[model samples]
Target: MSEQELKLHVPAVARRAVQQDIRQGNASRIRLRALYFDTPGRELARARIALRLRQEGRDWVQTLKMPGADAITRVEINHARPGPVLDLSVYAGTEVEAPLSAIKGELGLCYETDVQRLLRQVRSRHGTIELAYDTGVLRAGTLELPISELEFELMSGRPAAIFAVARRWQQRHGLVLDARSKSERGDALASLARELAALDADDPDAQVRRGTAITRFWAPRGAAAVTLDDTLTPAQAMGRVAAECLDQVARNAAVLAEVDTLGVYPAGQSEHVHQLRVGMRRLRSAWRLFDGWTAPPPATVLQGVRTHFAAFGQSRDQDVLNETVTPVLLQAGMPVITFEAPPVDIDAQAIAAGKAFQGWLLDALEWSLDVQPPSPASAPEPMAASDTAPEPAFRLDGSATAPAITPTIIPLATEAKPQPLHKLLGNRLHRWHAKVAAQGKDFATLDIPARHDLRKRGKRLRYGLSFAESLLPKSRLRGYRKLLSEVQDRLGEINDLAMAKDYYQACVGTHPQAWFALGWISARLDKLIAEAQQAFDRLADTKPFWK
Candidate 1:
C-alpha cells in the first residue's frame, strides 16, 4: 500500500521527553533490523528507489519504496518473507515493478540499520495517523552513525493530519524537518566508507586522518530551475513551482537548524540563511504572480510568512552593513561608528527551525497542492495594483517616458472549463513586465517606498521567468533574461545601501558620529542610484522577451 509519512528529527535534548511521552501512551514497541541493497553502480540509489529486507521481531518483511506524487507521499509495497532473505519477484505486478526489473547489475548489500521502534496510532480532527519513533544506528562496513527520528504514517486520514501532528511535536520538542530517507542517508554513509577504504589502499605512504575526514558534510541545497511541461493547467504549473520552493526552503532550514551541531557550512559561509530567505522570497513572488490565476493561500498564513520574511531581512541587512558595506566606508576615511541594535538580535537558527515558521510552510504547501478550481462568481481576483505596484513619481527627472499601461485582467477559470495554459502564462508575464518596466522609467525620481517596490516588482519578474521559461521561445528568453538579471542585481545593490542609509538616518540623533556615516552613505547612494537608473533605462529600448 502507498504510505504517506512525514519525518522529523528530534533534537538531542528532547529525546528523553519524547520517550516519556511515548511510554505514557498505549504503544507497541519492537526491534527492527533492516538491510538495504543496491546494484554496484548504485542505480537504485541514483533513481531514489530503495529495496530492503527488514526483520520485525521474529518475522521478516521485504519492502520497496520510491518517490510519490507529492513530497509527503511514497509508493511502498511489502510482502511477508519466510526468513531474512531479499525477494525481487515480490514486486512483479506492482507499480514499482518496471524500475526494479530494469536494473542490470546484481544487487548487493549496501548498508544496514538497527533501531528501537515505538509505534502508536492516534485519531485527530483530520484523520487517523500512525506515529513511529525510531532510535538506532545506521551501519555500513566499519562506519556507523546514530539515528533519531519520528515518522508519522497515515493510517486513514487526510495528508494534512500528519502535518498537524508534526507541527505539534515540532513546537513542543524543537524538531526540524528532515526529508532525507533512511536509505538516502545510508547510501551516503556507504559512499563515505568506500571512499575511506580506497584512500587507505591507494597509498600507504599518504597521510590521512580518518576521524577528521569522517565528519558529515551537510551540503547546501537549492531548487533547480525547471522547464515546465506545456500540457499542465495554470493550477498544476503553479503547484509545481510552489513545491520546488518548499523543497528548497525545507532542506535549507534543516541545515540552519543543525548548524549548532555541524559547526560550519561548506566554504565557511552563512549560505543557509541566504538560501532559506531566497526560497521564501521566490515562494512569495510566485504567490503574487499566481494570486488571481488560481486558489489563494490562507490570509493568516500569508501574514505569518511576511512577518518571518521581514525578520530574516533585518538579519541579512545587518550582515551586509557590517560585512560588506561598513568596511568600505571605514577604509574611505569614515571613523568607527557604533550603531543602535535592534530590539531583538535574531536567533537565526531558532527562527529557521521554529514551529511557527515551519507550520506556515506546511500549510502553504498543503494549499498549493490542494488548489481548487476557481469559483465562477467568487473566484480569487488579481491583487490590486497597490498590492504590488510602485507609486508613480510626481515629477520626472529624466526624459519623459511612455505612459504606464494598466495590467491585463485575466478571467477566472470556471468549473466547466479553465483558461488556456499558454494564454494564462502570457497574460500574467505581460502584466508583470508592464508594471516593472513602467516604474523603471522614473526610478531615479521615485521616493524610497516606490524604489523599494520597484525592486520587489523586478524580483517578481525575475522569479516568474524561471517558473514560466518553458512556454517562451528559448532565443527570446536568453537575451531577456540576461538584461533582467543585470537590472535586478543593480537594484539589489541600491537596496542594500538604502537600508544602510535608513539605519544611520535613525541613529544621527543619539550618536553624532552617525552623521559621518550618513554622509558616506548619501554620497554612495547617489552614484549607485544613477548607475541603476541608467541600467534600467537600457531595458526600455529592448523589446519585452515574452513578446
Candidate 2:
C-alpha cells in the first residue's frame, strides 16, 4: 500500500503545557513507521510473526511490542507521518538487525476537530478482524475522553497488493476514510530508542530494565487547564467542566445516522449499540457515586438512556450472531440444521427487540447529550481528571496535618510460626471463591433481570478472588484464580448473549415482519448459549489453582 493510517484519540491532556520547550515543533504531533511481518508463516522471516520496528524523536514517547508468541500484528500510528525513516535506516538494529524498509506512502486526512470520527475507526477494526480480512478497513470513532480515534489498515497477502487493499479497505470501513499515513505506536517506540541510546546503563543487558524505569518514572502526567470565573482552583473544576462538555457533544451526536456504523459496521450497524448500554451502566455508577455530591441528572433523562441502551444492546447482539457468529460456526464445521428450536426462535425476537432498543438508545443518547445544565458553570466535578494528584495534605477542617496511613507489612516468622504467603492468599481466595460460587448457584433462582444482576455480582466476586491471588505468592490458589477468571469470562458471555436475545425477542414480537427476520437469527443464538456452556464445562475441568 502507498500509505497506511492510524488515528488515535488520546486524552486532551496529551498536549504539553505552555512552559515546556518545543525544539521539534510541538510534541502535539508525532511521527511513526514500521513493518508488519507474518512471523511463523515465512522462512526469510524466521523470527516468524515479528513486526520489525524503527522510529524517531524521544524514545520515551514511543511504545514497544510485547515480545511473545501471540504477537499477531505490530502497528505504528503516530501524530506525524514518516517520523522514523532516518532512525530506522541508520540507527536501528543489533547483531541480527531487524530494520524496517519504509514504503512510499503519504499521511492521510486529519480530522482536526472530530473526536467521534476517531473512535468509530477503532470499533470498525475490531468487528472486521472477526470477519477475516477481506480487503476492508475498520473504523472506530467517538467524542469522549481520552479522545476518540479511527484507524484504516490495508491488509494484503502481497506487498504489492497494499494500494488495492487500502482503497477497498476505506470503502468497506467508511467513505470519508483519510489516506493519511500515521503510526499509532511508532512515536512511542522511537522515543524509547532515543532514551536507550543516551542511557548510562552500566550493563548492556539491562537496557530493558532502564527503559521501563525511565518510562514509568518520567511518563508525562496529562492535565487540563481550566480558569474558573470564581476563586475555585483549576483542580477543583477542570474535570467536571471537561466531562460536561463531552457529555453535551456526545448526546447531540447519539441519534446515530442510518449511515453511521457502530461495532460491526455496515452489515451490523447497530453493534456499538452496547456503548449506550454500557453508558447506562456508567451513568448508574455516576448516580450511585455522585448523586449525594451533586444532584443527579433528571430521572427521566437517566431512564430514557437506560431503557434505550438496554434495548439496542439486545438488537445489536442478535445482529452480530446472525451476521457474524452463525456464519463462523457454520464455517467451523457445525451443522446449521441440527440445532434448531425454542432458543433459536427466542433469540430472533431478541434481534427485533434490539432494533427497537436501538431506536430508544438514539433518543437516550440525544437526551443525555442535549441535557441543559442548571447553569453554564454548575456541572459536577470531574473526578478522574484530578484523582491522580497526590492526596491533598490538609484536614477537612482546613488544618494541615499529617494523617498517618499504615503500610501493609509482611512480617517474617520463624519455622515455629512460619506463615506461607501462599497460605494467606489461599485463605482469602477460599473466602472469595466460596462467595462467588454461592452467588453463581444463587443466580439460578432469580428472575430474568434479577438472575442477570446476580450473575454480575457473582462475576465481580470472581474477579475479586482472582485479584487476591495476584497479590499473593504462586500457589494452588493461583491456579484456581485462573480457572475462576476463565469460567467467569465464559459464563459472562453466555449470560450476556442470552439476556440480549431474550430482550430482543420481546421487543421484536411487536413488529411481525421484523419478528420473522429475527427468528432466523434466533436460531444462531441457541448455538451460542451451548458454546458458552461448553466453555464453562472446559473451565470446570481444570482443578482450581488453590491448595
lDDT of each: 0.79, 0.36
* Top lDDT hit: 1
In terms of TM-score, which candidate is strongest? 1
Mind giving the per-residue lDDT tens digits that candidate 2 earns over 79-172? 3234332233332453224423332332222111111111111123222211111111222122111222333343424322322333343333
Taking all chains together, each candidate's TM-score versus the true structure is: 0.79, 0.30
**In candidate 1, residue 442 scores what lDDT?**
92
Model 2 bad stretches (over 4 Å): 1-181, 185-314, 320-432, 441-446, 462-478, 481-547
Collision count of model 1 = 0
Candidate 1 lDDT tens digits, 128-234: 88889999999999978678899988888798898778778777887778778999889988987886777765565434545445544455676568667758866
Model 1 residue runs over 4 Å out of place are 39-41, 82-84, 87-107, 140-145, 191-216, 259-269, 326-344, 378-417, 500-531, 545-547
